[model samples]
Target: MQPDDLVLLTGRDHQRVTVAAQEVGLLPGTRARVEGRVLDVTDTDAVVGLADDLSTRYGGADVVISNAVARLLPEESQAERADEFIDVSNTATHTILRAFGPVLRPGGRLLVVASSLGTLGHLDPRLHHLFDGASLDQVEYAVESWRGAIHHRTAQEAGWPVWLNVPSKVAQVAAVRAVAAERRAHDLAASTLIASVCPGMVDTATSRPWFSDYSQAQTPAQAAEAVLDLVFTEHVDPALYGELVRFGKALDWHDGTPPGEQDTMVTP
Candidate 1:
């Protein structure tokens, strides 16, 4: 692993990750070269450029972390923008994989920050659509495609490890669990590690202020530390590569657990 690794942060989540990296003496432009390239993960230009840049610089990345969320609500809540949560998540994830697939070095790491909402249902009644009439089989198929694309792209060149972290509600865990099971059954090339880190109610600037009312709400720093612990650890599994890591309650990555238990595999 390169001492000076290249880190890419897309969208608002970058702010939190940036602070965490800085605390670890890995700030961009200081410890590692940090590039604030603002591009819509769903945009073709941005995705393509990301791939090109990653391939060119560092030959491939030691780690690629994505915290990009799809546009859920409309610019004007009253305006008519499609509330297609599935489409946004699938498209953004697919675009990132397709574009940057070729640039992840073998054994290199890719961490995708997904909400637990993707797995567990009923956390928010409004998101019931994710589970309504939803089949785990179909969800598995989508996840396989994602893992396959990344694996096939880097196979001959330099295969890398792909990890996914889906931390949200019960609904999110269900989604991640189904996907991990499917990946294992299919036996995809590149390893797909999945974990769910349920942070309960995260009191971030982006989240509703009312979230603070929750006694269990966690700070952004706390969450970021949990994520970092998972990303840096070894003992990754290929069979159960995908695991859902819950964050709140008693479970946490930063609290010093067993070696492998601390790492939550994910797909990004």
Candidate 2:
């Protein structure tokens, strides 16, 4: 990647991102050459428009980061608003990939912000069937199925948060893996690397209001740095291309262990 490559940051709030960009030394005049755009990933038209605009203006993106996320509020999960959870977690990610995947150039990188909860072994038993032996099509079905279940529930049961939080992440990572396989089989000439990463309890304004404690959480800058390390580093291991990374390390999802357990595992 060029030192002055354009880094497009999109979100619902471009102003806040502008401030963030400045703090990260990614302003208009800076060496990072960053620009911010207001985008609602949930809106299909908006997402398509952004991709078209990017393709027209710059040919394609060298790096695409699908980091737009929505967290469940403590009270909201108690109600029948599971649709919101599904939209934020699963649907939004699906939309982003569909719209932007074509616009990613050869030798580019695609990184989605997944979570530790996404690991199949780490998921709650109640939702294990959703992921067990699931193909990408099955994962998508699971997300829609959960949304429908929440809508039809007769009681004010509070299972939305756990279901939405982890399952959505599971789907995200699974999508990354599936896409990597497809890319390898069909677009081998591109040599693009696509994967997801868990930022590990980032202590941001978006998270602080929901998480009970900020202790041990990484700052936004710190988390971004870890991702950038993976993004910019040359000669990445082929095993990491389709895996879920954390703290600049890749985890083996099939190891039958939670992500935390695999964190200290030497790759010998």
Candidate 3:
């Protein structure tokens, strides 16, 4: 973030939010205005309220980033707590898209911070078309189908990945695609850019527990470089729109996951 930028940080915990604000000012020469709001991102009403507050107070946001997520992997049965992924993580992402998509200023960007395990190739091949929706509603239906499969205790049999995290993230990447198409249809694509990014296995306190081996993982600083590159670039290539970008290039939707990345279970 630049020194002139005003940043708003939100999370459920007050102390963590305050500390995050403090951390943003740690660098001596970096002096961006940082504010914190205690919020439950999973709540649609609260998220929209925040977006409205931004619009009324600051005219609108130049950039919107949705990074809220639930457990990367749980040792217990996915069937037991499948709602956490959908209701918490997936809902938070879609809510950001719904509320903020309309309020983003011209030339603004919307970036979804997802995971490298977010590709569709891990799921059964036949189900791929179900996720390639041009509209948000249709894309979301793919996630709902997985929810139905899990509720029926037939997710595996239905060709859905056993871990809820994978499908949830697939929905995230797919939503970016949906947003890109919507912008293009609305004639906003010429002014705005939208993309999803997979910061490959960053070794952060929050993420280390998700993997058994973290030796090869990049530090949080390493991961931020690629993300900031997109955020700081004055204009991105039109080809990057609605695509899942890794490093600096876009990945095909059918691309597989990184080796042993997600709970050490997702195949490479």
Candidate 4:
């Protein structure tokens, strides 16, 4: 980012994010101008308020990265709350893009932080019918169906994180594709690029509980590097504009088996 480029960071907790920004060299007038606000991505009103503040403060964002996620551990009482998972992983993701997509400048980039586990292959072929339509309604239906399928089971019985998270992310990836298609068809003048990414298992609050083996996990900075590569790199392929990427490689939905192997990465 340039010295003049402004950074607007929003989250539910502002103080921690502020300190973290400062730690990362994002200062008021040194490296870049930084602004932090407490905002919830799931609250439509809060999200719109933040967007309005952005317009009043600095017009709009050039890039929007949707990385909000929620994880339910196996031991948690309501770990089987698939509805909440859908809200965070699918609805909030589309909400972020929908709220900010129009204001994004021409050639701007919109990235949705999705999971590698989010693929049609992971779902039973019979369940694929949910994602066949182009409308957002279908997206919601797909999420609801997946959630309902596992709603009655406990986290341990339902495979904890994967069952709920994978399908929610699948809905999100489908949403991202729809968002990209909408941008291409309607916002022809702006020509924005929207893509999804799986930031390989990182040792963080949401991931650590489910993925206990963090010995080889990427640090927060290392994961950010993957996101930065997509944002600043000049050699990005146009084909990746509406696809899912991980470790700098684009992933194609496979047919043989669902992920979770030594050579394959399933979670984000």
- Which candidate achieves the best lDDT against the true structure? 3
TM-score for each candidate, following the candidate numbering: 0.55, 0.80, 0.89, 0.82
lDDT string, candidate 3, 1-268, tens digits: 6676788888999999999888876757777888888989878899999999989988888888777766544466667778876887677788898999888887787889887667777556767787766478887777787888899888777777766667777788888888778686442444676889887877766566556787788987898788888877776677677788888888878887422234444211
For model 3, the superposed segments whose C-alpha errors exceed 4 Å read 1-4, 72-74, 185-191, 257-268
Q: Which candidate should be chosen as best, given TM-score against the real structure?
A: 3
List model 4 lDDT by residue over 96-179, tens digit each: 777787677666778998888766677555555666445566776666655665665533343323456656776787787777
* lDDT to native, each model: 0.45, 0.68, 0.76, 0.69
Q: What is the alpha-carbon lDDT for the whole of candidate 3? A: 0.76
- Cα lDDT tens digits for candidate 1, 1-268: 3456655555535666566545545534465545454566657676788788777865765555555543322122211222233334555554554455456565444455565434432222332344334445444353444345444564112211122222122323445444445444332354323444444456655454223254566777777776666566564545324444544222322222111323332212
TM-score of candidate 2 relative to the true fold: 0.80
lDDT of 1: 0.45
| Residue-level lDDT tens digits of model 2 in 10-125 | 67887887776666564444666666777788888898888888899989777788887665555554335557656766787777777777888877788888877666665545
Q: What's model 4's TM-score?
A: 0.82
Which has the better TM-score: candidate 1, or candidate 3? 3
Q: Give the 10-residue window scoring lowest on summed lDDT in candidate 4.
A: 255-264
